[model samples]
Target: MTKTNAGRFFEDYAPGQVIHHAVPRTIKMGERALYHALYPARHALYSSDQFAQACGLPFSPLDDMIAFHVVFGKTVPDVSLNAVANLGYAEGRWLVPVWPGDTLRSVSEVIGVKENSNGKTGVVWVRTRGLNQHNEEVLSYVRWVMVRKRDASSAAPETVIPELAKVVDPSDLVLPKGLHFDNYDFTLAGEAHRWDDYDVGEKIDHVDGVTVEEAEHMMATRLWQNTAKVHFDATVRPDGSRLIYGGHVISLARTLSFNGLANAQMVVALNGGAHVNPCTSGMTVRAWSEVLDKAETSVPSVGALRLRLVATTGAPFALRGEDGKYLPEVLLDLDYWALIPR
Candidate 1:
């Protein structure tokens, strides 16, 4: 009997198949400390327990991205081990706040699949949910990845691409229980800009850049427990360079946005996102944001802003070119909804 286990390939997935991932993680203060060290995340709600309590939370909750990374890490072994690329994300929601000492596990259902015309690879879509020790779902999202087929000669499965929403309805966003921003402290939050201060179609240049280092990216990926070969093994790509994880760019860009959007605190919904271009070590990442829209939430003094966050290496605020294709300089394009004080 074989005692080894190889990860899943494109042909191994079928619509409606469910996968329960392994290794539930119990998050603590160490994860929070390392996250702050890895990225320049300084949002007040996630930084101070007193700040969080004043907003009606029991105490400070872990950064929303912390829960995202933990859940994403658990799915890598089963979902993306043989992936060519993690293509995109859509319709993601944060259902519950994750606190210290909460244990989390991941469960995924294969939602759709379509083989490429070349037959060497296929796109697989899965809806994954992160659940706590009490079996309550904390987060949910849909992401699709391009995965290599183990045998190129194998027949392709029937195509079943899912019809995903282009954007999450503003009314559907979940606000943390007891969250009220009426008493939000602007001085401590580091910015005085409120939700009403931002107009639709406005743009803000974040004005800060960070040069990525090989060691830093590797450490961040390892911390998330993402075991994707393309992120670690140079031999996996023809260019002979490890590909930086897309989530890394997302976090970097979000942190950079604090310069002008310090009050856009919690990311409630991921409407859509794309890793537009491959990023490697040594690129200087700059970020910018465009206010797409805004909405009033039922929660007291809490509002939502729809923003487009773009990450680039050549310059800030340049995205698609004349051909409507992402420019080579563009690294990440993310569309999401965030909570801000009204």
Candidate 2:
């Protein structure tokens, strides 16, 4: 018997089956430092312990996306190591602050699966939760990926497409304990705009761009411990280029949004997201965001804004085309709820 791991194929999944990802990562200041180096992340709450204390937290927690990346990275071997593409996401939530030194692992349950017409690939949907060492869930999300089949003649599994929410209800958003912005400092936040400053349908061009370097993409993927072959193996795809990890684009887009949304700290909920186009190294990425909706949370000092963040290489504010298909220039389209000072 071979000891090497080949990862799970599409046929290996079944509804209701659970998988405990094999790796548990202990995140620290070093991860934060390297994350900051990989992306231009500068949210004050995550930058300074003093700022976080002023905002009523004991200390600055890791950036919300750091928890996300760590959580996402751990699930790759079991969930997406054999994936052809990670298609979409829905109903995501960041439940607790991930403090420094917190160890995190992931558990995923197969929720849906369906074989495609070609018999060469199938789509698998799973609800994955990132749990701390205490077994407390820090983050959760539903994502579906297209995976290749190990045997073309294998019988198809029962089709089950899960009913998913298009948006995470604001009432269900979990706020970190003791987090308040009653005395928020706009000066330190880097942008004067508060939750009220943004109107629904308002669009903000972040007005910045970063060229993705091949080495940086490789480094970022390795930093997250994402072991997908597509990111590291240029020979996997017909094109002789390594595919940049989607999380890299997500972080880069979030980093670019800081210019206009500096005060929009703490990502609380991820409603949905899509990797519209393939992103490879050497493409310059730009970002824009539109306020989709707004709601008041129970926290007296905090409010939530639902924003559609778009990362693209072409132009700002251009998404779908006449056929309702994503434009060729768009890379990622993510919708999430963020907390802001009231």
Candidate 2 stretches greater than 4 Å from native: none
TM-score per candidate, chains pooled? 0.99, 0.99
Per-candidate local distance difference test: 0.95, 0.95
Query: Per-residue lDDT for 50-142 in model 1, tens only?
Result: 999999999999999999989999999999999999999999999999999999999999999999888999999999999999999999999
For model 2, where is the 10-residue window of minimal lDDT?
19-28
At residue 170, candidate 1 shows an lDDT of 98
Write one digit per residue (lDDT tens) for candidate 2, span 1-342. Answer: 899999999999999999999879988899899999999999999999999999999999999999999999999999999999999999999999999999999999999999999999999999999999899999999999999999999999999999999999999999999999998999998989988899999999999999999998899889889999999999999998888999999999998999999999999999999998999988999999999999999988899999999999998999999999999999999999999998
The lDDT, on a scale of 0 to 1, for candidate 1 is: 0.95
Q: Provide the lDDT at 48 for model 1.
A: 96
In model 2, the number of clashes is 0
> How many clashes does each candidate structure show, in the order listed?
0, 0
